[model samples]
Target: MPKRRWLVAPPAPSTFSARFPQFPPLIAQIFYNRGITTPDDAQRFVGMEDVAANARIGDDPFKMNGMSQAVERIRRAIREGEAIGVYGDFDADGVCSTALLTEALKKLDAKALPYIPHRINEGYGLNSDALKDLKEKGACVVVTVDCGIRSLGEVEAGTALGLDMIVTDHHSVGNELPRAVAVINPKQNDDAYPFQEFAGVGIAFKLAQALSDAQQQSPLPNAQTLELDALLDLVALGTVADLVPLVGENRTLVRRGLARLNKTERPGLQAMMQQAAGKNRSMSAGTIGFFLGPRLNAAGRIEHARTAYKLLTTQYPGEAEQLAAQLEATNRERQKLTDEMTQKAREMVAALPPGEFILIAGSPDFPEGIIGLIASKMQEDAYRPAIAMTHKDGVMRGSARSIPEFNIVAALDECADLLVRHGGHAAAAGFTVDNTKYDALHARLRNIAERELSRLELVPTISIDAEASLSDMNWKLLEHLDQLAPYGYGNREPIFLSRNIMVKSARLVGTEHIALVVSDGVVVWDAIAFRQKEALPKLAPLPKQVDLVYTLASKVWQNEPRLQLEVKDIRVADL
Candidate 1:
C-alpha cells in the first residue's frame, strides 16, 4: 500500500472558540473543520437544537418534483384495490426501499407486491420479465426504488405492457427522462428540492411520508394508519449503507432513525442484532455501516436479495432467526470470495504498464456479484480509479470505484455510446458493454482518467480533524465527541494527530494488525493499528517514538470499558 497524505485542519480562531464557549477548543475546531461556523449551526449539528425549525425547502415532501403525483397515484391504487408492485435493485438500499414502501402500502390496505430482481439472472433496475410477472399477478402500477432514472428502455417497455411506472431514484439522470407516469428524483434540473443527495431509501421514505399524510387526511375504511417514524429505521439503514452525505435532511433522518433502530421491535432486526452479539452495544452509524450493512448486502451478493428483504420484513422470530443465520454464513462466504478475487485483480493491475492513471481488471471467472468489492479494494490499494469486470458469454459487466479527485460516473457518461447501460454516483458506478466494445470502452475510460488525473497528486489522503496530545485522551473528550453521533460520508468521525508518541509496548495481534501501548511521557494509552503490520519494523526498537493519527474509541476489557486509540496511520518521528 502507498503512504497516505495527512491533511490536518488548521486550528480554529480563538474568537471562533469563544463564540461556542460551552464546547472545548478541540470540539470547536472539529465543528469549524466541518464548515459549522455559527453557534446556531453548531448547536443544530450536534443535536442540541431541533432541525425542524431550521428545515430547508426540501424538507417538505410535497416540494419534491412528482411527489404529489406519485402520492395520488398510489393513493388511488389503494382506494381502487389495484395491486401495486414495488420494484427494487438487489443492493441494500434497494431492498430496504422495497421493504419500506411495501410495508407502508400494506398498512394502508393496499395490495402491494414487492419484487427484487435476481443479481446474477435479472441484473438491475426495472426488467420487462419482472414487470410482466407483476402485471400477470394483477399489478396495475409499479413503483421503482433505487433504480430506473437512467433505465429509459426498461421504463418504456414497462409502459408498453400497460404498467404505470413511478420512478423514485437518486442516481444521476441521463439525457432524456423516462416516460413514466411520475418521475421523482431530486437531481432533476427543474427540481426545487434544496437537498439532492437522498439515498434511494430516503426518497422512498419521503414518498411513504406523503402517502401517510394523505391517508391521515382522508381515512381509508379498515386501513391501519402507518406512523412514518416506524419506517425511518429502514431509511437510516439504507442511507448510511448507500454512503450518502450525512448532512442536512439526511443527518436529521439518521439521527432520529438510529434512536428507533436501537429500540427496534422488528423481529428480523432483533434477530440480526442478537446474531451479531450487538444487543448490549449502543447502535451507531458505524454499527450499521460495518456490521449490519454488509450482512444485509451479503444476501444479494451471494444469492438473491429476496432473502434480505424477507429478513427485514419478516415478523416471525423463528423465520427471522433462520434468515439471520443464513445471512451470516453468506457474508462469510462473500468475504472469502472478495479476498481471493481482490488478490487476482491486484496481480492483473500489476501486469499493466506503469503510470496508468486508472486500474482496470477483468476475468471470466470473476463472480458478477462481488466485482464491486474487488473494484473498491483495487482503488483503495492503488490510490487510483479502478474498474473490475466479469466477462461471460458475449457481454462484460463491470463495477467502478474512484478516488475523490475523479468522478467515475461522469467518466462513464462520456463513453455513453460504447456502453449498453450505466448509472451511479460520482464515486461509484456500474456498467455493461458488449465484448466487442470492451476494448474500446477500456481505452476511452483510461484516456479520460489520464486527461483528468495526470496533473493531480493521486495519493490517498487522511483528513485529520484536529491535533491533540496523549493527555487529551480522556473520558470527557470522548463524551464531547459522542455528540457527533452517526458519522459518515459528509460527517466523518473526528481523527486526531498526536505527534512524537513513545511506544511503551508493541506486539502483533494478527498477521496484518499491531497492538501497542503508547505514551507522551506524561500519559499512556492503549492503541491498535489495524492493517499496519508493515510498520512493525519501525517500532521494533524499544521506546521508539512516532507520530500517530487516530480516532478515540472505547473497548471493553475484563468487563471494564476503557478508552483506547484506534490508530489510522503512523509515521516515524522527526530526528
Candidate 2:
C-alpha cells in the first residue's frame, strides 16, 4: 500500500458576501467557497426551475443530424402497423428508456416490444444474435437506447434483414457508426443537439417529447396523444443513477422528475421502496441512487437482468411484489459478495511493490458483477486509477475507476493493442484482456498512472466550503443551504471547517456511534459521530478546543427533530 497524503484547501474569500449581494451572507459565503460565483448560476440551480421548459419542443420542429429521419422511420412504422422493437441497455438508463419508448409507441398505436440484453451473458451494447431474434419476432424497426453507439455489426445484421434501425444513445462514438436510419447521440461531432451530456434516458425522453409534438401536429388516425410527464420518474431514476452532470437539461429533468416520483404510482418502484423501508418519506434523488438503484441493479448484477426489466414494466401488484422481494434478496447476496471481494482485493494490493501509482489486482473469485464496485472502492481508498479483474471464459475482464485528474479510458487506449475491446467515459471504463498478458498490462497501466498522477495529486482531499462560527448553525441557514438539493457527481453539499470549539461532553451511543456536546461560547449543540467509537480516547480529557469540518443536517428520530453535525474530518485546534 502507498503512503497517504493530505491536501488542505486554500482559505475562502473574505469578500464573498460583498461580492454576491443577492444571496444571504452565509449562503453567499458557502457558495463562493464551493466555487459557485454568479447569481444567475445559483438561481438556475438552487431555485429548481419551476418547469422543465427545455423539455418542450419548439414551434419549429426540433432538428438534429438524424432526429427528423429517426422520427420519420418510427412514424412510418406506426402508419404501416408494423411491429417495432426497442433494444435497451441493462442499467437503470436502459430500463427507463425501454419503458418510456414502449409507452410512447403504444399511444401511437405501434406494437413496440422492449428487449434488454442480459449483462452476464449478452454483455453490453447490441449483439447480432439478439437482433436476428428480434427480427424473427416480426419487428420492422428497431430502436436502441443507452447503447449501440459501437454496434456496427449488429446494425448491419438488422439492415441486411430489411429491418430499419434508429439509435437514441449518449455513449461516445467510435471511428465507424452503425448503419442505422438515424443516430441521436449528443456525443457525435456532427450532432447539433443543444446538450450532449444527457444520459441514455435523457435522449430517449427528448425523442418522446419530439414524437409527442409530431403526433399533435398530424394527430395519428385513431391514435391517442402521449403524455410525457408520466415517464419523468424513470428519467430521474436513470439520470441520477448513471451519475451524469446534474446541470442544464439534466437538472430540469431530475428536479421535475423527483416531484413526480414522490407521487409515483408505479407499482414496481412502489413495491421496491416499500420493501426497502423508504416508502414513508418523499422520494429524493438520494433515496433513488443510494437505496433503490442498488437493489434494482443487484438483480442485473448477480442474477438475470430480466428480473429488473420485468419489475420496472410490471403492471400487476402481485408480480411487482414478487420481483421486488427477489431483488431485495439478491441485493443482500451482492453485499456479502462485494464485502468478501473487497477484503481480498485489499490484501492483494498489500503484497504489491511498496510504492506503485496504480493498483491492478485480479482474482478468479472476484465476481464479474461486483468487480466494478470493488474497483471503485480501491480508487477511493488509494486515490488512484484502480483496476480489478476476474478470469471469465478464459479471458481476463476488468473494470477501471479513475479520479477526476486521470482519464481511465484514454489511459486504456494507450494500451489498446493488449485489450480485446474497451470503451467508456473519462473516469470509469471496462475492458477485456488476455489472461496471459495480465502482468504486462498491469506494468503498462502503472507506467501510465505514474506519468499522469503527480505525488501531490494522488491524495484523497477534503474540500471545505468556508470557516464558520458555531453560532452560525441555525435553522434558517440550514434550510437556505438545502436549496442546493439533489447533490451528486458535479454538485456537492457544502462542508464547513470551524476551529477552537469546546467539547463540553461525550459518550458512546448505540453500538458503534459517539455522541458529543460541543460549544462555541455562543451556543451548545448535540452531535453524533457514527462508527467513531474508536476515537473516544482522542477526546479523553474533554478538550476545550477542537477543529473539525462538517455539514449541518437535521436528524429526525421517533418524531423528535434536532440539528446535528455530520462530521467529515476532525483534528486538534491550535488555541
Best by TM-score: 1
User: What lDDT, from 0 to 1, does candidate 1 have?
Assistant: 0.90
Per-residue lDDT over 344-417 for candidate 2, one digit per residue giving the tens place of the 0 to 100 score:
99999889887778888898898888889999988877777889988877788899898888989889888888
TM-score of 2: 0.92
Q: Tens digits of per-residue lDDT for model 1 on 410-504?
A: 99999999998999999999999999998899899989999999999888889999889888778888998988877999988999999999998
**Model 2 Cα RMSD, 1 decimal:** 2.8
For each candidate, give its TM-score against the true structure. Answer: 0.98, 0.92
CA lDDT, every model vs. true structure: 0.90, 0.80
Alpha-carbon error at 374 in model 2, in Å?
0.8
What is the Cα-based lDDT of residue 70 in candidate 2? 86
Give the residue spans of candidate 1 off by over 4 A: 48-58
